[model samples]
Every structure is written in structure tokens, then in C-alpha cells.
Target chain A: MRNFFVLAFVALTALALPSVAMAQSAATSAASDGNTSGVITVIQVDSETNLVGFVLSTQNGELVEVSVNDSTSFGLENAAGDRWVSDFGEDPTEALLRITDQRERFAPVTVTVADGVASAVVDREQGDLERNLGFLFAIYIVTWAGFFAYIFIVSRRQSDLAREIKALTSQVG
Target chain B: MAALPKIRLIWLGFTAALMALTLWMVFLWVPTEINQGNIQRALYFHVPVAWTAMVAIVLIAVASVAYLKTRDEKWDRLAVAGAETGVIFAALMLITGMVWAKPVWGVWWTGEAKLTTTLILFFIYVAYLMFRAYFPPGEQRRRLAAIIGLIGAIDTPIIYYGAQLWERAHPSAVVGPYSNNDSSVDGPVGLTLLVATIAFSVLFVYVASERYRLRKQEDEVMALRRAISLQALRVATTSDSTESISSAPAGGA
Candidate 1:
């Protein structure tokens, strides 16, 4: 029964991720007018003019410009699978600050385009991940979990044998 | 009686520290890959566990050979324990590899050379365990298991060289000094992988040793059961003789 549960857990985790990502992508596409997905190749910050945004290298080898403004929304999947969103609400600098704070350079993102300008950049890479820290945690979890589970099974068997030894020794005595 | 609590505690502490340091280095310190991104980080733990599995196979072969030569049950017990531990690590290696593959290779599994060989290796050890179960406790079982173990050891090298020998989807080694592909990993990434390897190797040793001790306990239990049964038979036989003698005079009168 315990083995069944473990197998179930692993199967669910393996099967759930792709669909979760697909659902997120579908939702984003449904809500937005035009969505273009690409890898962020450049970020230009000009404090002098209060302008800050990034450039994305699209799959078709096109370079698209994205600027953060007050109406712009920033969101990424956290390590716990929670959607963390920050709407700068017309403060382009605030939106840029949030992006810098949350994202690594060159991360893949899906940008919502409106009237030839980028509105909201959804991180496609982040959505694919279980969490920012999830992949690393998973590595550790699988390692330690497998180790301990083996130990637990061994210990149970050992206990049974030990009990048998004790009973047989008593009988002999 | 063999495993000292203090020593186990110390090793546990060290393992925990090393594991934490490795995790920190991997997540916070190592640079993310330009292509694979965070998924590449899985390599740090995956490769190490795979290496541990290979090492465990080597140990099993050595122990199996020693058992065949010396006929020491201890060696056979050690071989079984090692294989059990190896199976755990091999499973981890396969699962982690699959998880990493989906995002990077775009597939959950492939019948590529390295992957196929690894799957075969896993089955061989699993078969080792099952082979031990089919026969009763005796020379035949031990010798047969030892021979199978020695034969199974052959696959480890084939799996290791599978990527290089075949034009396969799996990449060549990237973290070790002896790795064929040097450009696959950067300095910090390589160092993190090295540390992760060390940590997993140490954990393997600890787990395998514990398994060996447990197997020994099991053997002791079986021996005690046999001894108790023999003693019971002796007592029953003596009581029957006394009863027969006591009734013989009455029958004669």
C-alpha cells in the first residue's frame, strides 16, 4: 500500500506539470490580444528618461521591444507554484524594477502586444518550472526520499527478523 | 553491534552539511544555463547518483567474487546489500534523468544506447535479488547469485561508454576531469556537481553499510531459528524414548 502511494505521487507529479503549464499558457493567450513568445536578449534601463524595458529574441529570429509602464503587469510563477503578480499601475520604472527584481536575464517570456508595443511580459520559462526553487528541491527530495524510503523498508524487515530471532532464542533457552 | 551510534551521528551531520552546501551552490551560486536554464541543474544530483550506482555494482561484483572463493556468507550478504542500495540509486538516477529530459530533450524516454543500457543494468541487479529468492538457503543459491552478479558487472562499462560509442541523445560526461566534453559546464557549475557527487557518494556508502548490517542480522535470525528447531527435535526424541521404556516393563508383566 505504501509503495502504491509512492508510485501514485511520482506519477501525478510527472503527469501534472505539462498540463499545468499548458493551462497557464492557454489562459494567458485567451486573455491577451496578441501573444509573442521569445527569449529575453536585452534589457535597456534609462533612469534619465525614466524608461526601462527589455528586448526579446523571438523564435522566428525577430527582435521585439517591450517597455514597462504603469498599466503594465508583471507576473511570474514562484517556487511554490503560486502566481506572483505586481501591477505597477502606470509607473514604468516600478514595473521595470519588479522585472529586474524577479527575473534573470535571457529568461524566456511571452509578451502581450497592443498597438505595436509590448504590454505584459509573462515568463514562459517560469511557468514551465515547478517553482524557481522547485527543480533544486526536487533533486534533493528524490535523493533523500529514495534513500530514506529504502532505509525504512529495510528497517521494517530487520525488525521482523529481530523479533523472530528473539522468539527462537527464547524457545531454545 | 557493528554500527556505532556516535559514528553514525557524525557521518549524518557531515552528510547533511555537505548536502546543504551542494544545494546552495547549485541553486544560488551556479550560473543558469543559457539554453536549458534551471533544468540543467538536475545534472548535479543525477550524474552523482548514477556514478554511485556504478560504484555499488563494482562492490557487488567484488563481494560476489570473494564469496565464491572463500565461501564466506558475509561476502554474499554484502553483495546482496550492495545491490539493494544500488537499485535505489539507479532508480533515482533514472527518474531524475527522465524529469530533466522532458524539458530539455522533449521526451520522457528514448531507446537510446545509454538509456537502454542503464535500464538493463537496473534489471540485472533486480534480477540478482530475485534470483537469490528463488532457491533455498544453500551453496547453490550463493554461487548462482555470485555468478549472476559478476556477469551483471559487465553492463556498467557498456552503459558508461554508451553515449561515446553510439551517436546517442545522451550527452557525454560534462563535470568530471575525465569528461570528454569540457565546454558543457562552467567552473561554478562543475564545482557544484563535484560537491554533489561527493555528497551522494558518501550517502551511498552509509546506506550500503547499513544494509549490509541489516542483512547480517537477518542471517543471524535464520540461524537461530534453525538451532531452536534442532533443539526441540532432540527434546521430543528423548521424551519419546523414556515413554517407550516406561511402557515396556508393564507390557512384559
Candidate 2:
């Protein structure tokens, strides 16, 4: 039984090792460089000054203001995983401005900003990444903890009872 | 005496490995849902654990009925194991559901039909386990427990029908009137959910089997102790009578 457990642990570790290469780094990669990923808190469109911008709330609680322009690229994704986007040189009207008018507040986004000027706005379904990660980790921990604790208690009791049974049997004999 | 049967060990190892793989897929491979985002990943764990809980209660009910009909202690043992294991899974189901709800639903809990029914199931499981633990050990205890187990399973369907029966708020079932609505809920589970369900199923089976084995050994110990005590009492009684006779007046009472 001990050997079986050791072997199982080794096998599971080996199985886990291969997943590193397949890990999706979309969130991490998007967070790198000057790009910012967060929920949109407020959108400011100043037609008087011909300026369109929005305030982004990052995972760190830092609010960064981003400026959008006609030259800015747009990648819009809705709840169904359907996407609509335009290149940097293409018009942002078909994607960005229309979504700006119709979208809900605090929509998740990743804005590629150079000097606070948005070059690319990917308004996809990036969720509450940190809180969600915490939740998933918590649930997983709770599950394993509950199982292990139960197993430990059961095994210990079984061992104690086995010893008692052996001793009692000998006495009876 | 604490040694597990070969079949139980196989299930344990398989459950562990599958659970690890399921965790990887849930945390890494699956894409963040478009709407609910990463919290949607909770479905992988939540649904599977919930399903296992449901399965556990059913097993408890079935085992109880079998024990009743067969008058077999092994079936009684199985029902006990199911009750214990069911409580754990059911608690996890409610907890994971609450955690998942906080982010998406903006509340720790809701009065949605499915959620309410699942909570009821959890409570029933708890009540069944408490009854089993606190009650006296014997035919009476087993009979009453079996009755409870059989009845407790009734909540499972109530939980399943929750979405259709009254839940019209958040997420709708795939087959109900609300299924056609724009409820941006996730169900009709995808491949990851399927894998998770399979993993948790194996886990539930493994745990219950372990508990069952333990219960059997415990019964063995109890029977051994009882036999030893009875034998000792009989010997004491015989020796006492012999001493009294040896000390009594010759031919006198």
C-alpha cells in the first residue's frame, strides 16, 4: 500500500509536469508591456474636444485613464464568445463607438496604451480575474481538505479498532 | 485488519489521478467564459460535487432499502458510509455554489429554485448523518436510519427541478420554459464539466468505499469485544458456582 501511494504520487507529478507548456498565458501576456487589463469604470466622450477616453480599474485598484482615437484598433467580444474587431488603421466606429453606446458599465477590457493613448482596445470577456482565481483556488482547497481530513480520521479509527479486535480475540481464545 | 480491498485501492488511485487532471483542465485549459468570466470555472467543481452528492443520497436510499429487505448488516454498513460521504459532498456543493454566486449573482445566496432545493438536500443529508451518529446502535437504529435514508432522497429531484419549478431569475434550465430566455447562465455543461463530473464521481465512490470498509472492520471489532465479554462472564459465573459449591456444607444447600 505504501509503495502504491509513492508510485501514484510520482505518476501524478509526472502527469502535472506536462501541463506547463500548455498553460494559457493570455491574461498574463496581456498584462505585460504597456497594456492594461481591467473593468471599465467610466467612459468619457468629449465631442467638444473630439476626444474619447475611459477610466480603467486594474486588479491592483489603480485607475488608469486611456484615450481612444479613430486610428485605435477595436476587438469586441460578447458573452457568447462572438467577436468583432478592426485593425489599428481601420475605423473604430463599427466596433468601439457603437459598443461604447450600448455596453454595460464595468465591462472587462485590455487596452494597449502607448503614453496613455489607446492603440488597441480589446473589449472581451476578461472576468474578475483575481477574485475568480481566488475563488477557484479556495474551492479546490476546500474539496481536498475535506477529503483528506475524512480519510485521515477513518484510517486512524480503523487501525485502532483493528488492534483492539486482535487483542480481544487473543484474550477470548 | 485496516487493509483496503484491492478494488477499493484501485478506485482511490484512479480518483486521485483523475481529480488532479480535472483540476488542471479547470484552472488552466478551459477558457474564461465570455460573460461570467473566470468564476464560470466554478461550474467544473460545483456541478460535479453536486452530482456526486445527489448520487450519494440515492446510494444511501438504495442501500437502506436493500438492507431492510435482506436484513443484511453489509447493506446497513453501506448506508452509513453513504450518509457520511453524502454530507461532505453536499456541504461542498452548497459552499462552492455560494462562492460561485458571490461574483456573478452579486450575493452570497439567492432564493432561486435550484439553489434552494440544493440547500434542502444538504440539510437532509446533514439530518440523516446526525441521526445515524447520535442514535443508539441496533436493529431499531438501522431501521429508522434506513427509513430516513429512503425518504431523504426525495429532495434530489426537487433540486433537479428547481430551475423549472420556480427559478426564473438568474439561470434557467436547458429544457424548461426559461431555457429560451436571454438568461446568460451556463448549463448544458461542456466537455470540462463532463470531465469534472467523472472525476468527482470516482472520488465519491472511493471515499464511500473506504468508509464502508472501515465500518465493516468496526463491526468486526465490536462483535469480537462482545463475544469476549460474554465468554468472560460465563467463565466467571461457572467459577463462582464451583467455589460456592466447594465451600458449602457437605450434602447441604
Candidate 3:
């Protein structure tokens, strides 16, 4: 009955953990979206580099050039005066608009817009199984060694019994 | 105890032949998967290894119970062999799973049901072996180990159903009935997996039987040595007594 409670507690704890993690991640993503209204200005776009340098400007005219990859989603106006969200996948050579907020630069910062918006970025990292393979392999080897070691130890213990049997046999002869 | 027939050579030949045929079917005969490409080929090995591991554990439980009932050391030896082989095949399943996970699931490890359960089961059996090692030879040791084995076998079902319990409580990403069904396992993939499973099962039986035979042979040799020593001791004592009686009469006269 005590074992039952212990198992129940463990099961309950395991069941609760992932829900907590999911809730935490959701809250975190929600909190990070508060500053989404900052105006993004395109500065320079390189066709070959697939890099779109853009400046994020607040209402106060502060500018910071952030390099966005081909996978970045940017809403832009084309030469045909049509609004479209362009990314690297759809159009490789779309024109990008340079926006200036009354800066002291004579030249307009040039940026190029790609064809389609980046759908979703999938990041692949070294996972636990691959990273811990060496450790797991070590554990596996140790476990197998323990198995054979058990056999050897058992055989050694039985050796005493073998001796006892030998003594009895010698007496019988 | 009488010696069991030497079927190891025949099993070896059969396993080799089946393995060759399985490889031929997997590589040459089976067509590549349209969706998952070449990586889906790993399913042949992964599924079979998992199945074989399950079989090995069941065998271990059976042997453990048999040993307890009969007190035959052969059953104990078979149980150990089955557990050892089960662990090996379970590891293979895990490794192959990781290999398949990289391409398919986009992650090498997940807190998924089958994988985690199998991992826990593997560790449980490892602990079982450890428990066996700590105890000395006797009825108590055998009985205790057998009881643990039975309990461990019972846990297998819980591990298997953990996913279902979790799914009931939480919203899953791949929702809907039959959303992730393997509709693509029509032709070669199915055949390859079936063949691999059969071959591995045959291999498991062959290895377990051979280990049991070796253990029985060791016991027989020990028994023979004991008998020989007893005969020698009896002859020596009888001769000593006869010499002592003859010498004592002469000394007295």
C-alpha cells in the first residue's frame, strides 16, 4: 500500500511537469510580443548575400541596422503599387524601399525585397541522444560488465561448495 | 542430466541464410520510400529490434518463473541469458530510434511513450541483474530474484500505456483519429520488417538455448568431479584401516 502511494505520487508528478513547461513557454512568448510595434526601416539589401539590412526606428528617430536573412518576412510595396509580403523564397530580385526619418544622410538607404515571406524557420541542433551517446555507451558497457562480473562472482562463491563436495568424495573413497 | 542436442550449428546456418535473405529484400528488392527517402530504411531494423526486445523480456519472465517453480539452475541460467540479450536488443532499438528521429521527428529524443518506457524497462532489468549479484546462492536468493522479475514484468504494461494516459490529459500536436498512421507500409517496408523480426527471434532462441546447455554442462562436470573424489577418499580410508589392524596385532605379540 505504501508502494502504491509512492507510485501514484511519481505518476502525478511526471504528469504535471510538461504542462508546467508548456504554460511557461506560452507565457514567455506572449510577454515578448509587447514591443512588436517598433517601426522597421529597410536600409540596404544585397542580392547575392541574401541579407537585408534594416533599421528598427522608434517614434523618436533612433535607428539600429539589423541584418535580416532571406528567411525574414517584410511587408513592402512593389513597383506596380501593390502591397505584398516578400521573402527570399518567392522573388529573388524584388526591389526594396529605403525609408529615412529625416536623418542627415544625402543618399537613401537601399534595401531589396524578396518574393515571399519566410514561412517558418526550423532550427536543428545536436539533440540529447547524439550528445549523450558516449555517456550512454559507457553506461551500457558498464552494465554488461556488471553482468559478466556477477557470473564470475557467483562462480567464485560456488567454488567453496565445490571444495566441500571434493572433501566428501575423498572421504567416500 | 542428459545433454541436449547440438542445434547451435544448424541455428547459425539458418540465421545466416535468413539474414542474407533479409538484407537482400531490404536493399535490393524493397523500393525506397517516396516521402522519407533513404532514412525510412532504418524502420526495418528499428521495429524488429524493438519487437525482439519485447520477446526477450517475456522469455526472461517466463524463465524466472520456471526457475522458481522447478529450482532448476538451467532456468536461472536461461533467465540471465535472456535478460542480457534483451538489454542488447533494447539498446539497438534505442540507437536506431535516435537515427530515425533525426530525419523524421526533427529531434533525436523525445519524451515519447514507447522510447521512455523502453528506456526505463532497460534500467529496471539492469537493476534486476544487480540485485541478483548482491545476493548469494540459495533458495532465498532465487525466490527474491524471481519475485522482482515478476514485478518488473507487470510494470511493462504501465510503461506501454503511459502515452495513452498522457494523451488523455493533454492536447497533442498530431491530433485527429489515425493522423499519424503508417499508410505507407504497404510493400517492401512491411516485408523487410517481418523478415528481420523472424530472424532476430530465431537468433534469440538459439543463443538462449546455447547458454543453457553450457550451464548444464558445467554442472555435470562439477558433479562428476565430486563423485570421483568421493570414490578415491573411500578407497584410501579402507586401505588405511586394514593396514592399522594388521600392524597393531603384530606389535601386540
Candidate 4:
């Protein structure tokens, strides 16, 4: 009777898993477009002029380059009361830019371009396969260490018991 | 004792039925996947075997805890049986997974989470069996085995969740919808896998139970033989002592 119940329960669970998996898959498929909407703002600081400008990149891949005096493009009128001003000068050899999202979260990305290259190359330092391999190696070491430790403890216990058994036999004799 | 025979028969029947169903579902009912072709069929056995191996580790953990609490040899027996069974299934899972991977993953084996962890688990259980085989039957041996079993069982979840944790710690290769998709996410293929897992689990339980019963029986027979031999030695010692006393009397006369 117990065996029958176990079998029945297993069958029911087995029957139910497919439906659950299908529902999960359906939910995933519905949201599979993978479009994530977030604001990106870039603030470039020129050490030579001590001036800052902002660039915004949207989720739809639209890049909006805004200068300090460009108020009409931002739906604002140029007024004397405004503190914004643009300083037109020679391009600095180096620019330090901090890119922030709409929420003001900043990420540092350095862009470099070679001569006659149409595309600027961006580099972001992130975790890679070597780091993962290091983790795997750590796990392997810990697992083997624990395994050998257990073996050592077990062997010690066995020898201790054997000594105790010999002592008891000696007393009996 | 009266219920033992019935349980054995039921276990035998259950295993036979599960094996048949598994064969039918895997070979006939489950359709070959279009993307992976016939080779993907190995998932039917591989996944279930891995699942059963995990289940066996859990059982070993439970038995280990019970042995520690109760200090009973029976729990040790069960733990040994579970570990041995787990090792077998783990090996099968590794081999079958390799066979499936050769065509799909383009390598027979790689140090991936599933493969490496399963390999570690396999070695742990193999060590557990060796521990049992080397030790004589006693409370000390049982206690030692129980401790090892508990420790080995702790590695199961580490192996399982390692990949997820690894992904979170590392940069994902492909950042798209298909990146996180499990290979067994299809409808018919998922159903076939479910059936196979169930069948394999049931078979695993049946085999482990039978092996435990055999171990228990073997222990009992060994105990009985030891008792009989001790009794025979006692009888021989008494007869020798009486003969010595008689010879002393003859020497005095």
C-alpha cells in the first residue's frame, strides 16, 4: 500500500512537471524580445578648458549630443537668466568622460580610435573565463580536501577502535 | 521478517515495470528532436540518471543524520547502499552526458559545472564505498561511515547551484533570450524527460532498497556465524580444561 502511494505520487508529479515547464517556457517566450529601456548620459570634462558637456543614448540606439548653449534642442528657450554657456576652443588631446544612466549611475568606459578607423573601440573590464576557471579550481580543491580529511579521520578512528579491542581482548585473556 | 518477502516482490515488480515503461517511452514514444536529431535522445536517460544520483545523495544525507541520532548500524547500511547506488547512477549520467555532448557541445567532456560537479560527486561516493569495504562491521565503523556520508552529501547542492553562481560572477557569453534557455525546454521533449525521470527515480529507489535489504541480511548471517563459532570454541575449551584436571588427578595418584 505504501509502495502504491509512492508510485501514484511520483506519477502525478511526473504528469504535472510538463505543464509547469510549458507555462514557464510560454512566459519566457512572450518576453523574449530582450529590449531593455534605460537612460544613458555621458559627461565629458576637458582639463584644458574646465568645461563639461553631456551625451544621452536611449534604448532605441538614438544618440543625442547636447552642448551647454543648445537649449532649443532640449525644449528650452535661451535666456539671460540661464547659467548655461558654451566655450568654443581647440579640442583637448585627452578627455575624461563619466557615463551615467538616467538614474545617475556612472560607468567609466574609455574609447580609443585609430587613424582612418570609422569606429571607436570601447573597452569594459569584466569577469571572464579565467576567473570562472579559478573558481572551479577552488571548488575542486575544497572538495578533495574535505574528502581526504574525512578519510583521515575515519582511518584514525578505526585504528583507535582496533587498539581498544586489543586491550579488551588482553584483559579477557 | 514476514513483511520482507512481500516488499522484495513489490520492489522487483516495480523495477520491472519501470524499466519497461522507460524503454518504451524513450525508444518509441519520444520523438527525435529536429535540432539535435537522435543523439538528443540520450537526455532521456542522462537527465534522469543525474536526478536519481542527486536523490541518492539526499538519501545518504538523511541516513547519515539518522545514524548519528540513533547510533544504529542499520542507518550506516542504508547510507552505504545509497552511496553505492548514487555512484553507479552518477557514472551513468557522466557517460551518457558525454555521449550527448560529443555531437552537440563539440567535445566529449569539458570542465563545466554539471560535468565537473557530477564527477566530484561520483568520486566522493566511490570513496564512501571504499571506506565501507575496508572497515569491519562494528559501531565504530558505522559511526565513521555516517560522518563521511554526511560530509559527501553536502557537495550535491554545491555542484547543482555552481553553474548559476558562476554565471552571476562571470560575464555571460551571449546576452540574449536563447542564452538562458535550457536545452530541454521543448514540449514533447520535456514530457519525455519527465517520464524518464520518474521511471529512473522509481527504479533507483527499488534498487537501493533491495541492496540495503541484502546488506542487512548479510550482516545478520555474519553475526550468526560468529556466534556459532564462538560457541564451538567455548565447548572445545571446556573439554580441554576437564581433560587437564583429570590428568592432574592421575599425576597426584
In model 1, the Cα lDDT at residue B68 comes to 89
lDDT of 2 by residue, A1-173 (tens): 44444565456445533433333343443234465777777767566533377788887999999887776766555655455545534554455454564347456676667888887676433334555566655665566667766777877777787788789889888
- Calculate the i-RMS of every candidate, to one decimal place: 12.2, 9.5, 15.8, 15.9
Candidate 2 local lDDT, B92-159, one digit each (tens): 88888877765444346656665687678778878877887899888888899898888877657756
* Candidate 3 lDDT score at position A13: 40
How far residue A9's Cα lies from its native spot in candidate 1, in Å, is: 15
Compose the digit string of candidate 3's lDDT tens values, residues B1-253: 1232335456656975786576566545665543333445566666777888898889888988898889987777788777767776787777767656643444456566777778888898888888878987556776787887778888899877986576556532221111132646666677778897897677667655655554554555567676777777888999999999999999999
C-alpha lDDT (0 to 100) for residue A37 of candidate 3: 21
Q: Score every model by TM-score.
A: 0.67, 0.69, 0.54, 0.56
Candidate 2 chain A has its poorest 10 consecutive residues by lDDT at A16-25
After superposition, candidate 1 runs with Cα above 4 Å error: A1-139, B158-183
Clashing pairs in 2: none
Would you list the rank order by TM-score, best first?
2, 1, 4, 3
Question: lDDT tens digits, residues B1-253, model 1?
Answer: 5567578768766876786687667656666553344556677888899889888989999998899899999899889989999988889988887666544433456455556666779999999899888879878888999999999997678666774456455442221111112237647877888998999888887788778878888778878878877888898999999989999999999
Of the candidates shown, which would achieve the greatest lDDT relative to the real structure? 2
**What local lDDT score does residue B3 receive in model 3, on the 0 to 100 scale?**
31
Q: Quote the lDDT for B135 in model 2.
A: 94
Q: Candidate 2, which segments miss by more than 4 Å at Cα?
A: A1-24, A28-126, B1-5, B158-166, B169-189, B250-253
Give model 3's docking category.
Answer: incorrect
**For this target, which candidate reaches the highest TM-score against the unseen true structure?**
2
Model 2 TM-score is 0.69
DockQ of model 4, rounded to 2 decimals:
0.02
How would the candidate models be sorted by DockQ, starting from the highest?
A: 2, 1, 3, 4
